[model samples]
Target: MKQAADPAKERYALMEKIQMVDFALVELTLYLDTHPQDTQAIQQFNQLAVESRDLKSAYEQRFGPLRQYGASFSGYPWNWGDSPWPWQL
Candidate 1:
């Protein structure tokens, strides 16, 4: 039998993935700045970029925008100002 999906868990998972990818991108960017000719770092950065975008989209659709001004209307009466900041989780 299939189990019910947990929205909170799913949101946390996606947020974790997004943070990981963002961290990797930042690290790779720093490395690329010094090693401009490193093709591997460039490729990794590009891959992470796509991953971050997809993860953010999924999270926003399920949960809500990471930023206060991030596309509204998906949820309803615009609760972007509500509690439960990302760090609070």
Candidate 2:
């Protein structure tokens, strides 16, 4: 049977995925800047952008919108609305 997810745990997992996508985007960007003819790097950048959008969509679906200006997400309203609190772990 599938288990219910813990909100804190789920949020942390999403954060990790977002971090990975962030890194990939940066890496691809840097690579493309130096190697503009690298078709593989361009392909990878396209893939990373799609993946990042998916991750962000998932995050916004579960929690509030994290971005400052998203289509469907209102800005975080609560003071402590971002992520795992320092003591949550």
Candidate 3:
């Protein structure tokens, strides 16, 4: 039998992946600044950009906004206030 997925674990993994990708992108960008003609690095950066976008979208869909004002209000009576801090997760 297939077990159900844990939302908390899934979210944690997603966030961790996004951060790692973003960090890689930053490092690649710095390298490209010095080696502007590095096609391989440029291609990798493009791929990471697309991936980061998708991950952010998925995260926003499951959780609330990545930013406080990123999207329309969710939940009844302003649940954002009651929710745990983003860093807590």
The model with the greatest TM-score is 1
Q: How accurate is candidate 3 locally (lDDT)?
A: 0.80
Residue-wise C-alpha lDDT for candidate 2, range 1-89, written one tens digit per residue: 99998987888888788888989899889889999999988988999899988987887677766565335465456423565432342
Cα displacement (Å) at residue 39, model 1: 1.3
Candidate with more favorable, higher lDDT: 2 or 3: 3
Which portions of model 2 miss their true places by more than 4 Å? 70-72, 75-89
Superposed by TM-score, candidate 1 places the C-alpha of residue 75 at a distance from the truth, in angstroms, of: 4.3
Every model: Cα RMSD to truth: 2.1, 3.8, 2.7
lDDT of 1 by residue, 1-89 (tens): 99999978887787888899999999999999999999988999999999988887777777776655544434676667655666665
**Model 1 score (lDDT):** 0.79
Per-residue lDDT for 18 in model 2? 85
Would you list the clashing residue pairs of candidate 2?
none
User: Please, what is the whole-model Cα lDDT of each candidate in the order they appear?
Assistant: 0.79, 0.76, 0.80
C-alpha lDDT of residue 82 in model 3: 44
TM-score of 2: 0.77
Question: Given candidate 3, what's the lDDT at residue 62?
Answer: 83
